[model samples]
Target chain A: MTTSREIRLKSRPVGVPTADNFELASVELPPPGDGEIQVKNLYMSVDPYMRGRMTDRKSYVPPFELGKALQGGAVGEVTASNDPDFKVGDIVSSMFGWREAYNANPRALAAAGPMGGIMKLSTHGMPPQAFLGVAGMPGMTAYAGLLRVAALKEGDIVFVSAAAGAVGSVVCQIAKIKGHTVIGSAGGPEKVAFLKEIGVDHVIDYKATPDVTAELAKVAPKGIDVYFENVGGVHLEAALNAARPFGRFALCGMISQYNETGRPTGPANIIQAVGKSLRLEGFIVSNHYDLFPAFVRDMADWINSGKLTWKETVVEGVDRAPEAFIKLFSGENLGKMLVKL
Target chain B: MTTSREIRLKSRPVGVPTADNFELASVELPPPGDGEIQVKNLYMSVDPYMRGRMTDRKSYVPPFELGKALQGGAVGEVTASNDPDFKVGDIVSSMFGWREAYNANPRALAAAGPMGGIMKLSTHGMPPQAFLGVAGMPGMTAYAGLLRVAALKEGDIVFVSAAAGAVGSVVCQIAKIKGHTVIGSAGGPEKVAFLKEIGVDHVIDYKATPDVTAELAKVAPKGIDVYFENVGGVHLEAALNAARPFGRFALCGMISQYNETGRPTGPANIIQAVGKSLRLEGFIVSNHYDLFPAFVRDMADWINSGKLTWKETVVEGVDRAPEAFIKLFSGENLGKMLVKL
Candidate 1:
């Protein structure tokens, strides 16, 4: 028998989640059952949407239960396997909980689920951690949400919020590849610089900028055609005012309002959507699972051709998973926030 | 030379248009030239969109010139024609100004402009006035806006505001014909009764029911799947709250804000759209002109089969056009508001 370290939800959070909401414990790992794989967890993702799951309200996906291991997308090495499909030493990404080690049913680790939880990584010329960051769910989200939902066309101007985060980073790159002029908003100078390095046409440090709409107007004088919405509230309002007639907004997440005590105030200029004849659609990456194979092929091709780039902020220990998750809300992570056990 | 009575824009108004903002002038009609047709106007349409054209600001279409005749969809008789395609006594519709009579280039009066503003009427099996109402722009708006833009599917629950108005009246009928459960909101008890008589599955009188959201909740407990938006502001807010996850909203018009003093206060709960992954799209019926042939066929079939019904509130004499136009803002007209010359 071996000890496995795990982080479980101690209590539901009211506003932003804290360390008090999580309890770390060490439990004895049981032997792998038939058609199961015992894996040593290597990395776990700490995403902004995890904050929504900590609450007790009904949402697109279910809320996390108290005293249960918090589940997220994780990449690990299989130490033991009773299933023929997976073997010892085989590295795979799975919907494994936040833990140091665990035995998972092979059936549960099949492919991407309905809520867009997990998927196996294609071992091309990319880092294994990329599976948890840009080349994984976040990458697929930016691709499908911007291309399929927003119907981004060549020469269109794009504005991405939370610009240097996992999803936004990929969104900027994808927009550039599609021959669109891209402007992004980040919270700090370093992230803004990173965005510039990745070929973003323009970057704005939202923290230092007093007026977002004015800044956006200066960068995109012709007006934005596509707005990849990740941060809501003020960012949404700015995008709305800066958008041209017949603009399209692809809403993937609302990180700013995820942990609010009550309903967060939306953009004040939403009426502009009507006058401009705008198209605004909200979507989840999981809803497009049917297109995963196609996404993987295209993304891998971009990576191999030196057109795609990715970054990850890795936290070392499983015991520190809660802290890493909390850092996502504070905008501390530059790109994807992950825990390496 | 014949004297033509015309209504011209005197100045741009701040809020509700007044008599002082318009000038009724008696001008001499120009003689028809080669390829020109002299139109003796018989009827003129007064629509909510005319308010937008009254402003100097650019919109979907250009703003109406301050000193020029206010153009609208009008049906008239060809008193004289120098064009090979037209003849005397031939009734036709064109984007003619608010005038008793005028001479226009036949090329300018060809089929219809970009937004399908005018079309020759077929006065078969219907009243001649029906060509300006149900078989005209409002009817096509309902058909294309609901079916093409909203992508209405069978069994979907639809909610429409300003249900007794021209566009909304047709929208409910189209949704019903597609096998959808249709609910509508009108201003008074009389309008509510009219909505029910036209085969709307449910009706809510917004005046008697102070809480529109709660009223919608009682009828659409599963929440609305599609919202055909006509009245904006508070009504838009109610629809946003009552919309289900992945719901679609087609924003065709916003009559509520047309006469507002400034930027009207919009829906307070728009953040719900992000959480529910809803899709809200604003479109002009003219954008889907390629689908008009199909729309005319479908509408004609429904009308002839007794599956579709229509109503009109006709105000006689072209002099009453301004009064009829003002009544749209007050929600005083049921179905289409037309003025006969």
Candidate 2:
């Protein structure tokens, strides 16, 4: 028998999540039987989108149930395998995260679905944890939203909110590699420096700036053609104000509104959309997994050429996973926030 | 020489415009010069979009110049012609509205551009005044916005605001003719009855309805697939509230917020766009005139089949044109509002 430690939802959160909402529990597992594989998780990811799952409301994905182990992206090595497709010591990624180890049927893991599905990673000279960060769902999100959803064109100026986050960092690099001028907005001097390090043409430290709209106007005098929205509210209003005619905004995530208890006020200048002929479209990365092959190929090339890079704020051990998640809402993480199991 | 009475912008409006913002003047016109046509306008249009032009700000179209005649859609009879393309008694439409008569080079009238450009009408048993309303810019707006901008599909239910107005009434009929259930919102008993007369599946008298969002939900229990947005503020918030996944909104205008002195509050639930994966696209009718051929042909067939109808509120003389325009904000017009000279 093998014993594993896991975190389960003790109670749903009212506003911002607290460590008390999660409880550490341990379970004993018998030897893998039938088509099951045993995995020992090495690393797991915490993202802003998971906040929606905690709420008991109908959305694109189902809400997380109380008294159940929470799920997310995780990389692990197969400790044992009864399935012929995977052998012992093979590294794999799965949605069975927030836990230290588990035994699962291969078919069930595969059925975790897009962005949450299981996959075997070759690593290709990179760390297995890279699958939970840059080379994974967050990476694919940046690629699809900018290239496909926003329909980025030559000479189009790109603006990204939350520019120091996992998805936004990749978006910044992709726009640079494609030879377009990029503008990014983030909080604090550290994130501002990181944005500049990634070759962002213009950077706005929203923490220091009193009015983001005026700051954006001063930087993008000619106006932006594409807006990659990660933070909503004021950022959205600023984008609307600075957008040129026929501008396109890819609504990926709105982390700013994720923790709000009440309905938040939206952009007051949204009416500018009509006068300027803007298009704002919301999308989930899972919906565009059809571009996986192209995304993987392009990311591999960029990584090999040293054109793509990422940063992470890691917390050690499974017991601290909830704290890492809470840090995300506070802007305490510089880039991707991960828990090392 | 012939005398013409014209209305000019006397002052820019601070908020909601009053009669003092406009002025009436007389101008003398000589016989038609070379390549020129002299026209006596029979009917002039008073539309909601003109509100934008009255403000001194950059928009899709240039703002109306102060101390000059305000321009809009008008149908007139040619009194004299120096060009072979037109003859006396031939009916023509031009953008030189707010004036009873004018002599202009045919090329200048043709260069009025897109929705404001000049066109000689065949009439084809329809009244010449139809060129300024049902058969002109407003009809084209409803056509392109619904079919192309919103990309209406079969079995998709539609919700339209300002369903008793010029462009919106056409949108209602088109949805009905295409065999889709349509829910429309208008003010007053007369406007509500007009919506039913045009075969709208559900009609909400917004003046009597205290909660538009709740009323919309009661009528469209399955949620709306396509939203034709004309009235903004409350209607926009309600549409965002009841939108199903992948719903599309074609934003044509926002008459509700146009006269506001300060920044008005936007939809508090705009963040719902991200969760529902909705698309909101704003458009100007002039941008889609390439669909004019299809729109004109389809409109003719619909009219001949007796499946299409319209209403107009007319005020005699150019002196009352400003009053007619102001009545639009109060929801006093059932459908198209016009001024006769």
DockQ of each: 0.47, 0.82
Cα lDDT, all candidates = 0.83, 0.91
Q: Give the Å error, residue A12, model 1.
A: 3.0
lDDT of 1 by residue, B1-341 (tens): 77889888889977988777888888897788888888888888888888988988867789998888899888888898888777887877877848989887766645445543334566666765566667877888888888977889876899999889888999999888878899999998778888998889989899898898889999988889899999887778888888888899998888878877755675657767777888999887667778878977888898899888876777876667777787888888888888888
Model 1 lDDT, residue B175, Cα:
86
- The model with the greatest DockQ is 2
What tens digits encode model 2's per-residue C-alpha lDDT throughout B155-268?
899999999999999999999999999999999889998899899999989889999999999999999999999998889999998899999999998889889898788888
Task: Assess candidate 1 and give its TM-score to the true structure.
Answer: 0.93
Q: Judge the docking of candidate 2 as incorrect, acceptable, medium or high.
A: high
